[model samples]
Target: MALSKFLGLFLIHIALLSSSCFAADPFVFYDFEVSYITASPLGVPQQVIAINNKFPGPTINSTTNNNVVINVRNKLDESLLLHWSGIQQRRSSWQDGLPGTNCPIPPKWNWTYQFQVKDQIGSFFYFPSLHFQRAAGGFGGFIINNRDIIPIPFGSPDGDITILIGDWYTRNHTALRKALDAGKDLGMPDGVLINGKGPYQYNDTLVPDGIDYETIDVHPGKTYRLRVHNVGISTSLNFRIQSHNLLLAETEGSYTVQQNYTSLDIHVGQSYSFLLTTDQNASSDYYIVASARFVNESQWKRVTGVAILRYSNSKGKAAGPLPDPPQDEYDKTFSMNQARSIRWNVSASGARPNPQGSFRYGSINVTEIFVLKNKPPVTIDGKRRTTLSGISFVNPATPIRLADQFKVKGVYKLDFPSRPLTGPPKMETSVINGTFRGFMEVILQNNDTKVQTYHLSGYAFFVVGMDYGEWSENSRGTYNKWDGIARSTTQVYPGAWTAILISLDNVGVWNLRTENLDSWYLGQETYIRVVNPEVTNKTELPMPDNVLYCGALSKRQKYAKKSRFYVNGYLRKMAVKTNNG
Candidate 1:
């Protein structure tokens, strides 16, 4: 079968002139109804969340600078929030989708999110943020195309395809959450799925009926751009195509220097685009493989997910043995070396006219330095919890953004530490106070046994450096300041440290957390709270008109909300002039 298609981009252009017309960028909108449905992605029947009755939600096809408005109607019994994984909610934090920053849409209620894709291009994704919902369903590809004026660095491919590969569990999300709540560990996944499908003939002997795998129909001697996203909840995946090399092109909306490899390590919450040329024999199909990386094979079943790459005129299926994966080495140096090889194509234009590295990040002085650390989960007061810098994140009873906007005190503390603390972990609603427009250096120290992937919302930071052993002042000497690829999510291997340089130009409270869903739920997360003392309409948008005020602010405040307006297809923020309820 052909690749599951994306929602067609409807360009609603209005001509300004009669003869030689000028058309503005159009707004892309979708009314999404999130509800539950019975599906068997793992060959076991379970209820999964669906958007508009589609299991994997809907792929969003949009362009840079285009305003995207999604009206999400929640029909699940539990609350729901959807985060645009790599989309920087620049100047508009009200729609960031973190439960602490924005309120969740209650059951049977709906909320509309409006934000500009602004100066971004390439692969990304959106998924449900509340609870372990993502383990069951609710994820889709988000592609931002470059405008006509911008030039693509590589030759145009025959077509673009998106693949969502991840580990799967037979237990439903609710059962998984209950297990975690009871201080239990979720063992290995039952299977791995590609594009919301189970393995080929995985349960044919065990069960009479089972879900099948994905098949990508391709033409001989033609090339295609495949955008891959590791939407898995936990496991880190290494993806490969049999008898083919994956030409790395762009990652998480940034163009990278072209490099070819047989296998690629994709951590949870990561996205990439690779150019695959169909150069092999056309008589038989090929296997598309995604296997769990850093997983022990002796004690547990090998997590191998497979799909098919078929030629249009093919006669039979694949017959050869699967490609050999890299040996499971305790010291994962080969993957690290491969990651280090990916660099930014500094000369290529992204969504804007300027080159990728037009801003000389090395020349800029860092205003602040932070050394955050993570440790393995420990049983605290009869519950397993993960800590970031000695603090277990506690979600506040109200939205922190609404509290900060109304100057409500005591909603959250801004005393989050810049370094790990000395004693046992503590739970608090805490955040890091970041100076607006400050170029900062952040080092994430991973002392945990497993590889950790961290994701920063509202901004894509530069991965400057990473190394085994502990990080120190001397580690700065090994930094890659010249051409660090900019991306939202990065992996720091076990017992390793990764440093990033981020300029806090966006104003708002943003989530900085590990991508592991269990850890995030158990509190391996924090927020960077950036305050612009001289906030303006140009610098920040006003509070969303539909914001559900709670906590301290709900006690007294009510106001005629000054909202935004879509002026001729562009989003324009209105000034706040009233405050009283």
Candidate 2:
């Protein structure tokens, strides 16, 4: 018999055997109705696709590699598909759910997916594929691995805790889609939610039913594993327990060198597993704390969620709030110098609203800016543009012309503003010279001729070097600088920080050194790209850590428009990975 036919028969036989093991009573069929729900108290309807009307669908259990079957009935008007993230299946890429990989199941149509199980032993999550409709609010679930790579220290625990941190735009998921579709703007969610609930409650005096929240329960004397996943649109989170500590053991599905018992930081598209051993003798009552660490106005500062760690009478009593929450390890005051610095900024741009001027066709204009000094500008039109007085361009002509004239040399458009770089508008563009405050703000437009500009705060730059610029020779046959740093081979005096972006795609490697930076600024990041390219061979470029922005420069310029200085560059795929290599 063929392998396919044999597997189908085997699964049927196993299903029959499993059914026979149970009692004579009817099977307990768990039914879940998927739709959008809101947890935000703002009275706005946040669509949340859920099962059995629950934001997070019920859990599915079975032994690993078992023939697990699930009937997913779509009720929405759009087609839906599921994605088992990180799950590897041989010759089963058809079920990958990546759009364009195969035509997605049509609305109301049932597309049964069957594949052998092959995954690491741990907690995993499922989402309706990368399709916009499903992602907005659709199918989601947790996968538990009973097959253990290493036995649990305490054997199978009595219970498990899974904390999923996700964002909901109460108004309408369409609001977000519209923003992305129109090339408009989107801010961080207004309220932070944990387990589909928010914080802050109001009594009758303030406003009855103003806010209702839920907290997780924990017991003392018992060890618990916390599986934390951040599913916000795009934001890294720093979390801690209000009065207790945890032993962090794993990150991004990988084990740590040692159990790190401290409040930790986790970024989006990342996960962490922690082992908690409560104080057995004290009275039970502890709170779990998770907060967002965005540093810009447009970004949100949210208290994601809280859970109570309670113990049973058998274990003993728990203490009241363990001496005021210990200083968070990532506290800005203490961690300022210890943490490595990275260049970051929030940015946006535009293109003609006409149909032909679509972002996908590389016809939209884009601009990005950063808060720190010396960091190169966000790249657009194939290169980076730096600003001093308002949004000035650094070698803007090169990238813009290249993008317009050459199709193969297109630059990746990016936005990396963790928050809006906003302030009072004081400067205006001069029609005669196409300049702002004596500086050129190079504007790049789409085929439709729509233009965009960006600015950052408190940072100034001086031209350092350029690959196309004239530079001196080192006397020997070889060039002196690695890529682009000094203005010339003979003049290597820590080339002054310039408001210019060095296109990493072709430069091979480059450096952007900085000096004075705003005190309020923290690191910046975003998952933004204008182009979608297939993965290919390796390419070397300057890593974030080495792109230091502190240096000594003689000249300084002020913005007359009451605008902040900005750095521009396309958020290359390299910037998103912690370890680019």
Q: How accurate is candidate 1 locally (lDDT)?
A: 0.81
- Using all chains and alpha carbons, the TM-scores for the candidates as numbered come to 0.90, 0.50
Which ten-residue region of model 2 has the weakest summed lDDT?
514-523
Considering every candidate listed, which one attains the maximal TM-score? Answer: 1
Clashes per candidate (backbone, < 3 Å): 2, 36
The C-alpha RMSD in Å for every predicted model, in order, reads: 7.5, 19.6
**Best lDDT goes to which candidate?**
1
Please identify model 1 stretches exceeding 4 Å from their true place: 1-24, 202-209, 299-302, 328-331, 352-358, 553-581
Provide the lowest-lDDT 10-residue window in model 1: 572-581
